[model samples]
Target: MLKVDGLTKKFGELVAVNSLNFEVKEGQIYGIAGPNGAGKSTVYNLITGNYRYEGRIEFDGQDITGLPPYRIAKKGIARTFQVPEIFPSLNVQETIRVGSRFGARGGLDKKHSDEVLNFVGLEEERLQHAGLLNLLGKKKLMVGAALATKPKILMLDEPMAGSNAGEIADLMDLIKKINQQLGITVIIIEHFMKVLTELTETLLIIESGRMICCDRPEIVTSDPRVIESYLGDSYAEDK
Candidate 1:
């Protein structure tokens, strides 16, 4: 559904993302993993039009490399940040409505917004202020707002961060349902290997903005170079 070829981004002398190439199939959960400052988030920034990149990015067969961020969002791509972001003053329902209004080409749909709130398991909290919610609630709200945009592909950055085991399970189930039931393509950037193995079909590993490997989770995780460079010798032994 989305293809990136030779995508490179540099800030002065520092090459944040270098010649990164990958593809995300429709209705698939594609995972990206790398250590901190490995240009993982920078790739997303380049794809979403936050930076001027030296490469090609195509979605549904059209080039979107130099488009502005809002234009990219309008082109059926929506993303959630590593940190939960929402309007602190707005109620849950109102926050989602803002997304719907901005993202929907035809304007906001109140019924659809309400359904999105319920879909993210925030129905009862719809009228509550967004800042009053706990971490998990805020995260769910962030996902719900992104869903409200009606994106064909959803890119999530560290969606499981700061969650307990049960909350992680809940979010994982929700992500699976969003992919399997809703039929939206998913691109997730996460640190947890188990989560990637369980949820993603294709896993892309990168370091210093270069591809280490790209294959099925099982194959990529078992790769000797991948184990040595990213997963470490200890994780390799456990395998």
Candidate 2:
């Protein structure tokens, strides 16, 4: 479980996150959504210790606010960036193995690396250079690498970005398996309302770095503030 309270982040003159608070229970798929520059990703940064911020972040009841990223990761938190980041020169298997070195509770293991490669459906491409993979393949590889860390919670940033409908569906299925079969708590930052509504148990909407509403995805999507801030009137009517 993860808990964030009074989280605030400032970059010189601009406030990126303002007193944000949310809780992600164990085994739940929590979601976050906001328009561009709404500080959705900034919250992840603050939680993962990318920057110093005002507030407390607790993972499984331990304070993790100011810890460095590696330490946080070692405490069972793993994350993927908005863009798929892969080692261009490393083979797919090697790329995943490198991530295997960062397991939250123990040192790397080859069997776990193999399991991650297969879990993400990249077994056949394990020998290929990472730079050669297509967009979807690269995304899967990135997720596989994150899985290699054996995290209890995986924070995904726009995992559906730049994907076609089919790709989005594929990612949705994969995410489900990760939560169900792998039993990992998930916190996803996404702009796609349909994905959030369909996949998340709880959704949090924010604007100007503050919460607009936090509730069940269905309720959050229907909230007037959420509709006004991100989902347009037409989209709201369809929902």
Stretches of candidate 2 off by over 4 Å are none
Worst 10 residues of 2 by lDDT: 102-111
lDDT of 1 by residue, 1-239 (tens): 89999999999999989998899999899999988889999998988999898999999989888999988988889999999998999999999999898787677989989999989999999899999999999999999988898899999999999998999999999999999888999999999899999999999999999999999999999999888888899998887
**So what's the TM-score on candidate 2?**
0.98
RMSD for each model, in Å, please?
0.9, 0.9
lDDT of model number 2? 0.92
lDDT of 2 by residue, 153-173 (tens): 999999999999999999999
Model 1 per-residue lDDT at 150: 89
Query: lDDT (CA) for every model shown?
Result: 0.93, 0.92
Candidate 2 residue 215 Cα shift, in angstroms, is 0.4
